[model samples]
Target: MKRSNRLVALTNYFLENPRLHKQLPYFVNRLETTKASVSEDMDIIDAVFRNEGLGYLQRTTGAGGGVKYIPEYLHEKSEAFIHEMCHQLADPVRILPGGYLYMSDLLGNPKTVREIGRVFASAFSQMEIDVVVTVATKGIPLAYSVASFLDVPVVIVRRDPKVTEGSSVSINYVSGSSRKIQTMVLPKRSLEEGANVCIIDDFMKAGGTITGMINLLEEFNAQVKAIGVLAEADDEEEERVVENYTSLIKISNVDLKAKSIEVHPGNFVEIGDRK
Candidate 1:
């Protein structure tokens, strides 16, 4: 490959797989390029990315820290990339008999999960998302992944009380799917008044849990910067509550008999408008 093409590929690779970029010496040696040359190419790529309104790329200094890409790029290509992954996750074969899809693989896959997190973090790139919030269990990992990209702290909402934590403020919320009354608790010090909060979750059914989370934020007098979900099940009944939220993938249907699934892009097509 030509030098220019190689640089572009390297930069794009780093953007997609940041953890790999951190081991720069290894990559540099493998590519048979000097560290200085790689550094110069990275500078050029970073400039091009930012100039094109794609987003900014950052490199951290020191032994442990390394090059990282903070994507500001909101484009058709990125959206399509996320949409494709959502479709893959929507496979009907993955859907168990209970109409619930097995998404643990997608959620645990580091590359896929990180990409999904970056997609949402990009949406809040401009906003001051002081902290990321999510309910206990499944949402915790998603919340942590997004928080890592945003370089912000994560505040987990507990579904049940735990003995290790100190005093916590609790709220009663109805589950969107079950419509059963459930309690969510957060440490009083987890967030502060007037904090710019971003809420993230793995799935959304009724959005009642999100509503309760929003209420919890209100109790702290924090402003919800935005709400994002990895995947949303297109259930007509649960649609009412989550009408205002944004989802990366909209799973419209799962034809178990045919082993087919339907998916679509979310309303985030115009993420740049938020600026």
Candidate 2:
């Protein structure tokens, strides 16, 4: 095949099987071309991927050498998208009676959620994540979105035990905002032993829910690789339960009486800057 055709096919293959490594000889044989010609095609494809902020194509040397496609969303693009979300979240009309900003609209948007997933996936891409874990309801979409990009399955924790899920483990945790104890249930067989889990959530006040999920994972002997949230409520009085977590947007301040809300980029801004 022609070099142009080879480049297109190679690009598609990388996208279809991201985070996969393939030896140069495999490509050369598949394309029925010399190693030098295949290398030339890889160069063009790699350049396009990096220049377009698509991802990274890493080349390894030595006896067990190969090329790996690592998906990455450029920090600049992620920052811009997140800042735009902040503006949307800053709308005073979204402020509810309990100072909760209405985010159902944002969470329901497939396009928005997909982008947020990409941001989370990019943020935690360095980790060896095997499964995405989240609570039922609001967090399901976010969890699925991140899992899709990472090519992993999602494990959802439920408020009430379901008969359909079979045997399950339950744990009680304090609700940061409500200041009440609540039980969360997870299926016993949902996760495997030593599985690297990435926790994703929609909003966090004191991180009580995420904390509960962490405790529940203990039963399955899974490791928490990373944590990510779409937004985090900045409440000074309420101490955050989880220390190492990333959020896309920060709710700095909210006033129901004044109908005022303040939002800005979250910890990801600092993290993304370093990258």
Candidate 3:
């Protein structure tokens, strides 16, 4: 095939199978090309990917030589998208009761969710994550999106376990924002013991829900490798229990009486976690 056609096909394959390693011979046979030509193509693709602020191809040599694609979102893209989020969230119309901002619309948009997934996946790209875990409902989509880029499965912690899911582990904890007791469950088969886990959530207020998830993962002896949040309520009155988390946006102030809201970039940008 021509180099133009080969590049398109190779790019699509890399995107479809992120982090999947394949031998040079495999592509050489499939593309009907010489080893040197295949290597040149990879160099070109890697250069373009890095230039576009996507990600680069990781190539290994020797007996186990192969290549894998890493979908890392660039800092510039992440900051630009987060600023747009701040603008969208600044509208007073998003303010909800109890000084919480309505984010269901943004979370529901596939494109928006995918963008969030890219930013989060980029931030946690360096971790050796076994599974992406999230509570049922709002966080499910985000978890799946991140898992897709990571090439890992998603384990959902639900409010209640279904009979179809077989046996489960359950725990009760206090809600961070509401300060009410709540229960979350995960099926016994959903996660293996001592697995490396990356926790993803839609939003956090005082980090009660995230703390609960961490406590539950302990039962399985799972190590929490990383935590990613789409938005966090920066309520000064409530002391946050969970630290060491990456957030895409920070909602600092929400005034119901004045019909005004304040939104800013989250710790993800402040700390420069992504390259």
| Best of the candidates, lDDT | 3
Q: Which portions of model 2 show Cα errors greater than 4 Å?
A: 29-32
At residue 106, candidate 3 shows an lDDT of: 91
Q: All predictions: root-mean-square deviation over Cα?
A: 6.9, 2.0, 1.3
State model 3's lDDT.
0.93
Clash pairs (backbone) in predicted model 3: none
Q: Give the least accurate 10-residue stretch of model 3, judged by summed lDDT.
A: 266-275
Q: Candidate 3 on 1-275: residue-level lDDT in tens?
A: 77888899999999999999999999998998888988999999999999999999999999989999999989889899999998998999999888888889998899999999999999899999999999989999999999999999999999887999999999999998777999999999989999999999999989999999999999999999999999998999999999899998999868899998889999999779543
True-vs-predicted CA distance for residue 234, candidate 1, Å: 1.8
- TM-score for predicted model 3 compared with the true structure: 0.97
Q: TM-score for each prediction?
A: 0.74, 0.91, 0.97
> What ranking of all candidate models by lDDT puts the best one first?
3, 2, 1
Off by over 4 Å in 3: 273-275
lDDT, candidate 2, 176-225, per-residue tens: 78989999999887888889999999999999899999999988888998
Candidate 1: the clashing residue pairs are 54-73, 55-72
Off by over 4 Å in 1: 1-45, 48-54, 57-70, 255-260, 270-275
